[model samples]
Target: MTTTHGAHGICLSLLSSLSLSLMAALCSHPALAAETDSAPATRTLIQAGKLFDAHTGKLRSNQTIVIEGEQIVSVGAHQDGKPGDTVIDLSNATVLPGLIDAHTHLTGEPKFGYEELGISTPRAALTGAKNARITLLAGFTSVRDVGAPAYADVALRDAIDAGDVPGPHMIASGAALGITGGHCDNNLQPYEAHAQADGIADGVEGVQKKVREVIKYGASVIKFCATGGVLSKGDDPEASQYTFDEMKALVADAHRLGRKVAAHAHGGDGIILASEAGVDSIEHGSYIDAKGIATLKKNGTYMVPTIYLNTWLLDNADKIGLPEFYLKKEKAVAAVSFKNMSNAIKAGVKIAFGTDAAVYPHGLNARQFAMYVQMGMTPAQAIQSATVNAADLLGWADQTGALDAGKWADIIAVSGDPLADITLLENVQFVMKAGAVYKNNVAK
Candidate 1:
C-alpha cells in the first residue's frame, strides 16, 4: 500500500508540473502576447462641441476628428468607433486650428544692457530649446524664426524635427542682413570688440552677397533692417537704414533664391521703400502712415504688428533695466505702435499675426490676439490672421493653417468661446501638434 500511494503522489506532482509548463508556453505564444505587451492604439477619435472653421470663419458643432498617426484622417459627425480605436472627449471645449506666430526669435530671451555678453551661439541654441517648449505649450505650434545668431534657429529647428526636443514647426532665417552699424549689427559693443555681426555689409552688391550668404546658411527667409530700430544703440528709430537700391538688391536676391524677405521697418518712408523694393512682409511698421498703408495694399504687402511689445515695454520699462535710449524709444513708440496696426486694419492692408515673442515673454504670445481685437479686428478675423493669413505668408498654406482635411493636425482647444472673449486663448486647455496630444484638460 505504501508503494502504491508513493507512485500516486509522484504521478500527481508530474501532472501539476506539466500543467505549469503548458501555462508558460501559452504565455509565450504569439497569440497571447497581448496579455503581457499591449499594442499601441492606431486610431483616436476626438469628439468636440465646437470647432472653428478657419477658412470660412464659422464654428462647427459636435464634430468627430479621426486621427491616424500624425495626421487627421477625417472630421465629421459622430461615428461609432471600431474596435481597437480610442476616443478623447472634448465635447465641452471650443476647438480651433493651432495658432501660428508669423515672426519670432526662438533664441532671443529678454536681455538688458551688457547682459548680452554672456550669451554665446551654443547658449543661444540652448535658450531656444527651452523657449521653444514654452512657446509650444502656449499653443504656438508653428513659428517663423526671423533671426538668430550662428544658425541657432536652424539647429533648434532641426533638433525639433529629429525628435531630439520639443518645439514649433520653425521656418528659420539663420541671420538677419544689416548695414555695418544698423539694428541687426552689434552697435552696442565698441568697435574694438571685434564684434561686427555676421550679416553686416554695405552697398547694393554687399547686401546681395549677404542675402545669398544668409540663404546658404539655412535661412528659409531673408530678414533685413529697412529702418533703424528702438533697441539698437546710436540709431534713430524713425530713420531709414538701408538704401532703396540696397533694399531692392537684397529683396531681388532673396526672391531669386525662392526665399521671402521680411524687413524690420518702422518709419513710413522705410515701409514705402521696402514695399517698392518687393520685400514680401514688413515687421514692426511702428511709424507706418497712410501712404505706407496704401503702398502695402497696392503691393500686396503684409503688415505684422507686434503691438504688445510696445505696451509690455512701457508697462515694465522702469523695472526692466533698459538703457536710457531704449526707455526713451519705447515710451515714444508705445504712444503710436498700437495705432499703426489699427490704421493698417482700417485701411484694408493685409495683416498677419506676429508677437515678436521673447521681446516680452514667450508663453504670453496669445496676448497679441486680445490686442488685435482691441484694434477693431473681429475675433474670427484675428484668429484668421494667426491661422490662414500667417500660413499664407509663410508659404505653407497647403499644409497648415485651417483645420481641414489633408492639413496637418495642429489644433488647440479652450474651455470657453474665444469668439466672445478672445482672451480665453491665453489659457489654452488643450493642444495637439501633428495629432499627438501634448495637453488636454477639457472636463472629461
Candidate 2:
C-alpha cells in the first residue's frame, strides 16, 4: 500500500510540471505573448445633457461621449455606462468644445506698468505656471502664446507637456521677431543700458535668421512685429516696423520650416503688407482699413481682433499704475480700434477670437465673446471663431476644433445655452481636457 501511494504522488508532480511548461510555451509565442501582455484600454463615459455641435452650430440633447485613453471613441445618443468605465455626469449642464485663444501672453501679466522691468525670465516662467492653471480652469484648453521674453514661453510649454505643471495646450512662439527699437524690442532703457530683446533683428537677412533662430529654440509658430504696439515705449502703434520685403522673407522662412507666422499689425499699411506677404493671421488689426480688409479677404488671412483689452485697460489703468506713455498709446489705439473691427466684421472678413489676455488679466477670456457679438458677429459665429476658426488658424483643425470622434476629448460645460446667453461662458462650471477633468463644479 505505501509503494502504490508513492507512485501516485510522483505521477501528480510530473503532471503539474508538464502543465507549467505548456503554459510557458504558449506565452512565448509572438502573437500569444502580445495578447497576454496587453492591458485593457481605459474608458471614460461623459453623459451630457445638451451637447453643442460645433460643426453645425446647434445643440443635440442627451448625448454620450465615449472616451478611451485621451481620444474620443464615439459620440451618440445616451447610453448606459459600461462596467469599469469612469463616468462624468454633466447631465444638468450645457456641454461644448473647449475654448481656444489665438493670442495670449501666459508668461507675464500687467504688473502695474514699469514694475515689469524687475521681472526676470525665471520669474516670468513661475508667473506662467500660475496663469496657466487659471486659464485652464476658465475653459480655454488651448492657447497660442504669441510671444515671451527669453524663451520663457517655450519652457512653460515643455513643462506643461511633461505634466510637471497644469496648463493649456500651448502653441508657443519663443521671442517675437522684431526690428531694432520696434514694438517687440526692449526700448525702455537708454542706449547705454545695451537693452535689446532676443527677437531684435535688422534687415531681410537678419529677420530670416531670427525666424530660424526662434524656431530652433522651440517655437511652434513665428510672431513678428509688423507694426508698433500700444504697451511698448517710444513707438507709434500706427507706424510700420518691418518693411514688406523683410516681412516676405520672414514669412517665407517660417512657412518653409513648417511654422505658421502671425504678424502683430495694428496699422492699415502693416495689415496689408502682412496679408500680401502671406502671414496666416494678423493680431490686433486696430487700424485696418478698406484696402487692408480687401487684402485679408483676398489672401484668406485671419484677423484676431483683441478689442476687449481696450475697455479693460482704460478702466484699470490707474489701478495698474500704467505709465502715461503706455496709456497714451492705448487711448489712441482704442479710439479707432472699435470702428475698424466692427467694419471688418460687417464686411465678412475672417475672424478668430483672441483676448490679448496678459494685457488685462488671464481667465477673463470669455468676456471677449460678448464683445464679438457686439462687433456684428452672431453668438454662434463668435463661438465658432474660438473653436473652428482658431483651430484652423493654428493648423489643429483635425485635432481639437470640436468634440468629434478620434479627437482629443477637450470639453467645457456652462449652466445654460451659450447661444441664448453668450455671457454664460464667462462662468464655465465644468472643464475637461484630454479626457481628464480639471474643473467640475457642476458635479455634486
Q: Highest lDDT, which number?
A: 2
Report the C-alpha displacement of residue 214, candidate 2, in angstroms: 0.6
- For candidate 2, the lDDT comes to 0.92
Candidate 1 per-residue lDDT over residues 205-290, each given as its tens digit: 89888888877778898988889888878887788999999988888888988999899999889999999999889999999998
What's the true lDDT of residue 354 in model 2?
92
CA RMSD for every model? Answer: 7.7, 5.1
lDDT of each: 0.88, 0.92
Worst 10 residues of 1 by lDDT: 1-10
Clashes of 1: 0
TM-score of 2: 0.93
Q: Residues 121-213, candidate 2: write the lDDT tens digits.
A: 999999999999999999999999999989999999999999999998999999999989989988888899999999999898999889989
Q: How far is candidate 2 from the true structure (C-alpha RMSD, Å)?
A: 5.1
**Model 2 bad stretches (over 4 Å):** 1-22, 25-35
